[model samples]
Target: MAGYGRSDEEWGQLTSVGLAFLVERARLEKTTTYTELDATLRRRTGLRGFDFDQDSERAAMGHLLGLIVERNRPTTNLLISALVQYLNTNDAGPGFYALAVELGMLPRRSSATAKQAFWIGQLNALYAFYSAGRRGA
Candidate 1:
């Protein structure tokens, strides 16, 4: 299978490390003030303000990751639209997506297919990494 030029073992190592970092970052972001998070999301998604609570925003982050793995356009678009309408979202612009790129979920932005391939590769690697862990356990 195509990977980020890494062997299965290497990919697993990267995924484990990257996922740990992302989750911890999520937890930290949860602790920030709502006003601060709102401003950050505004800068990220170009939305005006946030109206949802911390819990909802946290849930949305998980939901976003799931959607990324699913790689369904309609569902992804629906999620994005809902977030825009409600002003509840994740720090994906500078957070999860960035990690995704580093983990080889996406090609560099200059690549022609970077946008399309990003989510697909990420989902593939995510499932691969977790499945490997489960088997080991």
Candidate 2:
């Protein structure tokens, strides 16, 4: 939970932007890369978004995504971050799985396949929740 120089209000705004973008993407049954999300955040917030190449910034994005998860956990109980993936590899970062384990959504001692299963489950749930009734409407 490092602040990374972002104030509470800033975090709130950034998280709001990210959540809205992700929800919309989910409704379209689409996935976005970290760089794409960062660009969207910068354009929407008028702030210098994370470089994403830097480790610190990557961690910051993870933290921001974690906040998104925490914000919607009560209603959805799903990792919305599952819709986000690394650009080089079409997979969520380790932090995504870490957050799942931290929240007890994924078992701590799970195998790689088990972890992937959990991520896929969350993603399918997200797609179902948002994509339902969104098409041809």
Candidate 3:
């Protein structure tokens, strides 16, 4: 994921929630329309990148909300808005790990336990998933 003011340490490492969170944050800072939201969501999501966090997720949703409040393209605005809704309600276990597995974001082989590998694998998985799939892309 692209970031504005992040430290180098935070650059290539983030959870799915963390990555989702970042998109939320960026969308907030930049103005977006329904057309913009949909287009941006599809465009950015179509690529492969980082996993956002709560702050970022909220920020992206905030951008969509701004569109609705401002009366921009309500459809696109609401479309992204629903994503925020899904994120809020859905459990992360399945969505989180599945993406990691499907995208082949994990290490090829490691002695780490399932939990360790998952966490390590999750970083790349979350980034690819959110940046390249239906969730956003």
Candidate 4:
């Protein structure tokens, strides 16, 4: 779709139906917490719950990826770490905040536009790198 972190065939790799439902459900329920979204995903997909208590951000992301297995959602901590590396390499953004909320690291309903701006800035910077990577060897 017309948004950040989107691709022409984003639908190409994602478990379209499942991820769509999960994203929609999270939005509908006003559920900003990662745990809530995970629970919803598990319930909908009949999958196991993530172990956030263990500081497993990677595992948490994997659970989401596992649910959205059709697309490249990322399946390990390495992906999350890579994303973090990319983010800090420049700055962060709304997408990053959404990710933080989805990971239960940050909550939804942010009042701090400054924080959102910071996150958005970070995202734009990373996008530039990824875009460049796509055009090169």
Q: Choose the strongest candidate by lDDT.
A: 2
**What are the per-residue Cα lDDT tens digits for candidate 4 across 1-137?**
31223343432223453445433432232213454545555676554555556646434444344435224234211112112222123433234555556765455766686555645553443344334234211
Model 2 per-residue lDDT tens digits across residues 16-124: 8898899888888888998899999999999889976688888788889988888876767788999899887767889899899888889899998998888888888
Query: What lDDT tens digits, residue by residue, belong to model 3 across residues 1-120?
Result: 344444333333222233344445334422223334434444544533323455664454443343332232221222222222232332223333333344454444423366355553
**What is candidate 1's lDDT per residue for 1-137, written digit by digit as tens?**
21323345543433343334333333332222334444554554443343445655544443333333333223222111111111253322334455445556454573535543553444333344334234221
TM of each candidate vs. truth: 0.26, 0.91, 0.21, 0.34
Stretches of model 3 off by over 4 angstroms after superposition:
1-40, 44-51, 54-57, 72-84, 88-137
Off by over 4 Å in 2: 133-137
lDDT of each: 0.36, 0.84, 0.36, 0.41
lDDT of 3: 0.36
Backbone clash tally (model 2): 0
| Model 1 residue-pair collision total | 0
Poorest 10 consecutive residues of model 1 by lDDT?
77-86
